[model samples]
Target: MSTKASRAAARLMISPSVILLLGWMLIPLGMTLYFSVLRFNLLMPGDNPFVGFENYRYFLTDPGFTAAIWNTLALVLGVLVITIFGGILLALLLDQPMFGQGIVRILVIAPFFVMPTVSALVWKNMFLNPVNGLFAHLFTALGLQPYDFLSQAPLASIIGIVAWQWLPFATLILLTALQSLDSEQLEAAEMDGATPLSRFWYIMLPHLARAITVVILIQTIFLLSVFAEILVTTNGGPGYASTNLTYLIYVQSLLQYDVGMGSAGGVVAIILANIVAIFLMRMIGKNLEA
Candidate 1:
């Protein structure tokens, strides 16, 4: 077929999928927007009355909203910090030639494949239970009191859990980027009397800048929606201590049966996510250009 005809045929074939994808995305967004303006409480089985931006107002003004926003930010930043640093160290170690390198790399990356809920449960029950858990046992052996991680330190515990899950991903990405670095530069720098730290600070870090930006951008996107871990571990409790925006929305919609308020929260989350995404995209773009 002619080039134009072939292009037309390709478009025709893909149009259905494109339309379906649009519908799948736009339809729920439209519904959420529609509901966000009303007083649609599931418990109040009656005529749903439109209340303009009342739902948004209520959702925003709620005291938990502030705490949730802060917690969400903390979780994202904490996880990012841990994963990036831990991943860099791991990547550096994994890049070195060693016995059983393949198996070691596989083990390092294994956590990323585990389901979030499963990992959370494992951490909650096996590691952080405080009673008969691994940490508890270790503390007892060390002549210290067992710490209630999820209770006394709910937010931090969740951060640790999330960081553990994401560390492997960061390591894999950084390792790939590290491997691509020309080793000759490092050798040359070493021969020129550059210290190990100096070489890493100047050569290795600059090479990983793009990959690091990519990791942050992608991780921040998903980290904003973290829910299962909180649900499985703290349930956003000790009373909103670990409640990120996602859990707060879940509380409004499912627990309180206020669909409108939940939808408003969802919209708010989308806006925040988009803002962060745009900022990260620009940052990554600049990094790539450099």
Candidate 2:
């Protein structure tokens, strides 16, 4: 076959799948954009009138919108901080020649496989419960007051739960990166009288920098849309305490049945996610060049 004919055949073979995927993504987005510009209420089957930008204006001015924005930022930052630091530390520890190392590695990575809902429920009811939880028992034993995590600090509680689920993933990534480091370089540094701290600071950290950035970027994407954990545990409150953008949109669309407002919020979320994706792509591109 000629080169052009082969290329044409390949394109024809792939076109159907590509077109299907595009439709799946673009069709809903188009509907959301259409809905965002209209004044449609689920409660009142009105003679629907298109009110351009009115839904966007209302969504922007709502008090919950501001709180949700802050909560989303806080959630992303909290997860990044907790998971990156904890993962790096655990990865370093597990890299050592410890007994039953394979078993320990499996156990360490097990939490990442858990369902978000299950993790949230376990944290909220079993671990963070004020009365019957392990923390409560420990508090009683220590002659201290029992602390209610969800009621007292819902955002922090959700952050902790999400962090627990993501930590294993970050650890495994960093650990794999660490394992691929050049051992001869480390030995040479040690021969030159580099202290353990100096070796890690000057060598290991630099080697793992790309991996760390990758963990941050990937986790940020997942963390931005954190819904299941919040829904299962805090339900976005004691009063907007844990209501990130995703949950805010869910409440608008499903609970309030305000499709127009929810679509506006959804557009805002897409913009935010795109901003993060741009930054992440730049970071990954730079890493690849290095």
* Per-candidate TM-score against the hidden true structure: 0.95, 0.95
How many residue pairs in model 1 have overlapping backbones?
0
Q: Could you report the Cα RMSD, in angstroms, for every candidate shown? A: 2.1, 1.8
Lowest-sum lDDT 10-residue window in model 2: 39-48
TM-score, candidate 1, is 0.95
- Residue pairs with backbone overlap in model 1: none
Mark the 10 consecutive residues where model 1 has the least summed lDDT: 279-288
Residue-level lDDT tens digits of model 1 in 73-92: 99999999999999999999
Q: After aligning candidate 2 to the native by TM-score, how far in Å is the CA of 176 from where it should be?
A: 0.9
Please give the lDDT score at residue 86 for candidate 1: 95
